[model samples]
Target: MSKERAQRRAEREREAAVLAAAKAAEAERHERREARRRAVASRLPKKRRGPSGVLADRRRTQTRLLVLAFLVLNVLVWLASGDWAVRILALVLTALVGPLVHILMTKN
Candidate 1:
């Protein structure tokens, strides 16, 4: 019985050692992959958008907002008025004024 117990203890120790080795290998592999990724990322070019790019983005945002506002206002007008003539008039006015509004808002 004592021999059997000793054998079982030895088996358990062997399994523990194998598991520890596997864990260490996995940690090493993870570190290697992360290092490679960092090296590649460091080589990539950094995007530097200057003042013109910023201004262009701002103008684009303003234009989009203006278009959204125009659409919402047109919808409101259509809902508020039952007359077809009033809806048509609203559409015409929006078409005429939209470009002017865009130009004024986007002008530097």
Candidate 2:
């Protein structure tokens, strides 16, 4: 009976040691991951001024191009179709909706 109790106690101690080691290892891994995340976050730019300005300029240029295209298409539709009602509707639709479409599709 004494020997059996000692063997059980030894087994229990071994399991506890293994659980403690695993917990310590998991904590170390978490600390390392957090350190790496902080390092990467620090390296990235916090504020973007130059790129945003350039992008805005490009968007303005693209918007102007879309407006031009919409105008040319409207004129073409009028000239080719030669129907007053169709031309009026097309012009109104293009003038009203073209800018909105341009803005929606624009990417920064």
Residue pairs that clash (backbone atoms under 3 angstroms), model 1: none
Instruction: Candidate 1: list runs displaced more than 4 Å.
Output: 1-52
Model 1: lDDT of residue 70: 98
Please report the TM-score between candidate 1 and the true structure: 0.51
Off by over 4 Å in 2: 1-52
Q: What is the lDDT of residue 87 in candidate 1?
A: 100
- C-alpha TM-score for every candidate: 0.51, 0.47
What local lDDT score does residue 84 receive in model 1, on the 0 to 100 scale?
100
Residue 57 lDDT in candidate 2: 86
Q: What root-mean-square deviation over C-alphas does model 2 reach?
A: 11.1
Cα-based lDDT for every prediction:
0.95, 0.89
